[model samples]
Target chain A: MHIVVCIKQVPDSAQIRVHPVTNTIMRQGVPTIINPYDLFALEEALRLRDKMGGKVTVLTMGPPMADESLRKALGLGADAAVLLTDRFFAGSDTLATSYALAAGIRKIGEEEPVDIVFTGKQTIDGDTAQVGPGIAKRLGLNQLTYVAAIRSLDLENRSIVVERRAEGGVQVLSTGLPCLITMLEGTNTLRRGAMDDMFRASRATIATWSAQQAGVDDIALCGLRGSPTVVKKVFAPQPRKEKAKMVETAGKSDAEIAQATLDTLFSANPKLETDLRKLAAAS
Target chain B: AKKELSEHFKTYKDVWVFIEMERGKVHTVSWELLGEGRKLADKLGVQLAAVILGPPGNDLKQAISDAWSYGADLAYVVSEPLLKDYRNEPYSKALTDLVNTHKPEILLLGASTLGRDLAGSVATTLKTGLTADCTELAIDDDRCLAATRPTFGGTLLCTIFTLNFRPQMATIRPRVMAMPERRDAKPGRVIEFKLSMVEDDIVTKILDFVPDTSTEEAHLAYADIVVAGGLGMGNPGNFRLITDLAAVLGAEYGGSRPTIQKGWISADRQIGQTGKTIRPKLYIAAGISGAIQHRVGVEGADMILAINTDANAPIFEFAHYGLVGDATRILPALTKAFEARLAVRRMAS
Candidate 1:
């Protein structure tokens, strides 16, 4: 079993603060972390490799700085890390990004027969869960998305069964191998690397592949030119002008305060009482 | 460079909305898209069509009539057993085959779980662009579809244009578009099609379906009132306050993404761009600092009341009402208040 997990380096969204005066994104002092979602994917891959002997290779496509993310995956017990970086891959949207990653995965397959590919359900920044399916389509791999758990994997039969999350229920699905899986978030807790694993990860020789090395032959299909959808504009959301109307709870107990607040709310918005009454009757 | 539609692509006409149905009922988002698609079709001087794929039954027939009432001029029906359960392979193949044969210029689908799963594969197989979770859709001056969605963690909105693609594709999240009035219109022209694939061809099979056990199955998108918590709740134990308040008000309860990550709430209860988009009459958010992700989900509420310890929580900026206090204490008080008020009203009546 040879598993390839795709990861990304993203600015810590929690730390990203909007400027007070300008209301613009404050990118300064925002540290980059290996996308938190991808950690779950890496952990799942490592668990699979531990059960069934195989090499887990981590792959990412970004600037040279993205190597840090790959190294972090290595520290978490992945066997190898590959970075696909080049100016040609810059300004790539999800489509172009999937194309580059697919090309990189094909090149990795030459070294060993790849059996499975893993990716986070989505990136925190892009918030688009398109790349995983796009890669699966490009490679013609069976896509098992929003997988909650791997019920079983029969390597001998080249098959696997997973619990896929869907609307209203969970579908127990079985599919063939050489497939792509995007594990849902919070499915498993990522493990901490042992002391020795961290040392080995620091010494690991990372493989760096340029666009040509990654088998991307068409220049037009590698960057902005390959992206059909263009973002016309970007702007901050406008704030509503009205501030909250505070309920005067002065010298009142919790119950009195609660009653007072409701009185004021109902008085100001009389329709609320009628709506709630109708809902109560219907229920 | 000004590009013209290729002669082969220029033949593509009509706007199509994929009517997402399961069991017997149609998803409301499908009707919402039809309402939006009708406008686009009218602007382009083309016909509006609805695509229905399900098992052969009266349910399919009812869906076709509902589509006409919602604004569809034509209906494309593919009744096959292979498409009954929505296996991605057969559905994508079937939808793609219909697109290739009929050549609809614009395609819209609900951004539900089934729609997202099918749209990705179909768009990729057809080598076209698909904008997911769109908040707005319109035809630009160039007669091209402009699909707008939040990007960069919902901080900014971006309009995506599929300039080179023949059949532009987009998925709109539920409640993003208002439902159109269902009119009493004549039945649409039905065009039946056949799917080539069979059960044996699909690699993936649904062995069993485990229904969710939790009783909080009220459709969050259509809820009348909502109460959501955020990381400010401090820990999982405090989430019960949200549910207690919701119980008194007959409102649905949810939380921010972090609450789901912390295992305080289930993914289904997450109120954000990634989870459920809600448009309730009254939304009470406690301990929520209101990130763009959470804001977009509840922004459509008719009235927003935010309670937080921090005076400068971003939620207060957009919220109609703000309370600068701890949610732990405030939630229980609010719950008791609403409960007492209701009890009094019941006694008086």
Candidate 2:
């Protein structure tokens, strides 16, 4: 089995801060990490490869710096890494990004047939959750999203079953091979790389591909020109006129403070007190 | 350039909301989008149309009526056995065909699992742009759909426009928009479409569905009130304080993303941008520092009461009320206070 796991390098959202006056993201000193969700996809791919005796290739589409993320995935036991990067791919939205990645996956398939493609449920920076399905649509692959577990895999039959997270329940789905799966976060823990793997990854050369090399026929479809959506404006959420009113707590016990807070809360919103009272009575 | 692109899509009219239904029940987010779609439709002076694709049944009929009551002016219905179960192949085909035949200026869908699954495929098939998890939707001065959504883990908001794409598409999460009042309205005209796809066309098959029987499943999004904890709760064992407080108020209990990472709570109960976006009437955040991710999820709540040991926690900036104290100490006290207050109110009633 040949599995291609798609990963992305995104700025650590937790550490990102907006400029107070300019009201824009301060990306200057922010650090970039492998999108945390993608780690789960890589680990799941590694586990599948280990069990089924196959090769796992990690793939990413980003700037040249994204090679670091691919190397990190190799350290985690992936057999190979591919970086699809080019100047023409900048400003690609989810649709355009998926188009580039799909082309890269097709090029990879020329050497060895890929049985499965894996991606995280969504990227942290975009958080759109559209790329996996987008890729599947472009490549004509069965799209299985929000997969919590791989229940069974019949290699001979080219069949796979997975437990998919749904709105109110879990759906056990069966699909053919050559499918795309978006692994949900927290489903599995990433493994620590062994000494040998770490050394191999540090020295492993990542294969880089431009849009043309990746078999993208149309340059217009690879970047801003291909993107249908345009970002009109970006700004910080407007701050409320007043900060949270603090309940007095100078030498006051927790109970007293709670009572005082409730009093103030009720006085400010008289309907809230009545609603709560009614709910309590019903409960 | 903008005018040329707009001219190409001039044939597309009206605003369409995808009404998602499964197993005879329509997802509430569908109605929520219709409510929001109504505003955009009115702003653009276009009709609000609900798109329904399902097996022919009373549920489908009821959804049509409900859409009308929720402000839809008309509906497009495709009743096919293949669409009974939402296999992305047929649903996307049905939706894309509808958009192609009768183009719409704007299309909205709920950001639920099913909606996301179908939207991505339909958008890709049609070569259109789709914005996901939009917090706000409106028609801009340019007569284009302005889809505003949180970006970079909700630290900033960005408004997106499908400049050249006809049927500019967007998906909004559950509870993000207010539920519009359902009024008695005359049922609107329904346009029926046929999905020519067959069973052999679908690649994925549903073997079985196991409904959530575990009581631990968190319905945080629709909860009337929510109480959540964070790393400041100190340890996993202290999460019970949040649950205890929730029990008194008949509210759901959740945790911040850090707590989920720590295994202090299940991932489903995580309340943040990466987790669930809730708009409860009352949100009590204990020990949480209110990262942008968490703030975006809970900022929709009618009232937010933040309790933390640090008075300067970022949570205090947007919280409606703040109590500066150890959550371990304050949670229990607050629980008791609520219990006593409710008991008194119950007795008085």
Candidate 3:
């Protein structure tokens, strides 16, 4: 069996600072890391590989710098890495993104058929959680999102069972192989890459692909032009109408301050009084 | 309508909330939206309406009456067998078709799992503006919908406008707005829309409905009191400190988005713009730095209490109460105090 994991390099959102002068995002000197969510998907893939004995290939669509992340995935035990980066793939929304990724996966299939495709539930930056569905729709792959656990996998029968996290509960689902699964975060830990593996990842020649090379015939559908939705603008949020009323208690005792704070809070929002009564009863 | 909004949006004129009823049960968030829709509708001086899409012969008519009592001026429904279960393709096409025929100035949807899925596609198909997980919705000085939500990882608040777009779109997280009282209990106009698409046309089948399983569901949105921890608590194991305080107060315990990002908790336990909307009576944030994205998710809480080592942490800006102290130190103290108070109460009982 052949398994593929799609990873992307995302700017460490925690360290992203806004440029003071232009108010534009400052991307320079900011470190990039594997999308924290994607690591869960990669680790799950590696675990399945160890149990089932399948080769794991890590795939990424990013700038040239993204090779850094691909190598990191390889260091963590991905057997191969492929980077699909081209000027045309820029400005792709979820739809366009899925299209490009689907084409790249097809190219990988030409070398060897992929039994399972894995991805993170959603990207922190996009937060749309639509790309997995979009890719499944386009590639005709069975789509499973928010997978919490791998209940069972019968490779001989070409069937896999998973627990998918839904709105209110988990669904025990069984589907055929050749499927795309987006794993939920915090389910598993990523393995450490050894010094030798890290060197191979850093030195590996990441197969690069352009739109045509990746089998995407329609350039229009490959990137921004193909995307139906456009983020016309990204701006700062508006300020609140009023600042919070700070309850000052410099010298008061903890109990006294707590009482005063509760009183002031209830006075501002009377419903809070009723809510607290309800909580107290529940307690 | 804007020069770029979909042709369908050009014809939309009033405010409509897609009254979501899943599994023969009405989502309570619909009522909260009715309360808000009334304000947006009144501000626009037009009718407030609801779009009910469900299977036929389900007493959806009663759902219509409830909408009237809740504040809808009219209810448009597409009742058919194919509409029984929500399939993205069919539902998107149906709602898009409705917006085209009857132009509404504003469209509201509960920022729910189903709502988010449908709204993203519908907004794209219509090519209009959509703001997801909004904390506040109000009529601006110019009478346009000013959608306020947290951005930039929950550090700041931003208000978005569609400018010239009509049928302005927004999704509010569940429990963000207050559900008003239903006094009039009147009936609104009900118009039924016939479904032409057959089930065969739809590709994906329900197969089955899988509900969430975690024993502790995050009630951050509606909890009377919430105690949340952050990375400042240090290791993932220290989250027990947060739960201890919550246990004594009978409150829900949550973690900032970063906690989930750090694998300290599941996404279900995360609190922020994309995670969950919590409007508790009191929200005590421990060790949280208060990024804009995280702020958007929790600002609905009636009162915010911040306990962090940094006095300048953005969480303090809007928190109702502030303590410039170590959360690792203060959280334990809070837990003990609440435990003592609860013990006193239990003995009295």
lDDT of 1 at A2: 98
Query: For model 1, how big is the iRMS in angstroms?
Result: 2.1
RMSD (CA, angstroms), candidate 1? 2.3
TM of each candidate vs. truth? 0.94, 0.97, 0.79
RMSD of 2: 1.6
Arrange candidates, best lDDT first: 2, 1, 3
Query: Which rank order by TM-score, best down to worst?
Result: 2, 1, 3
After superposing candidate 1 on the true structure, give the runs of residues whose Cα lies further than 4 Å from its correct spot: A17-29, B231-237, B343-349
Per-residue C-alpha lDDT of model 1 across residues B86-168, encoded as one tens digit per residue: 67888888999999999998999998878888888888777777888899899999889988998667776777888887688
Q: Tell me, by TM-score, which candidate is best.
A: 2
Candidate 2 per-residue lDDT, tens place, A1-283, comes to 9999999999998788888887778988889999998999999999998998989999999999999999989998999999999999999998999999999999999999999999999998999999999999999999899999999989999999999988778999999998999999878988999889989999999999999999998899988888998987889888777899998989998889888888878888888877787666665
Q: Scored by CA lDDT, what does every candidate get?
A: 0.87, 0.90, 0.76
What TM-scores result for chain A when each predicted structure is judged separately against the true chain A? 0.96, 0.97, 0.93
lDDT head-to-head 1 vs 2, winner:
2
**Stretches of model 2 off by over 4 angstroms after superposition:** B1-3, B6-8, B215-218
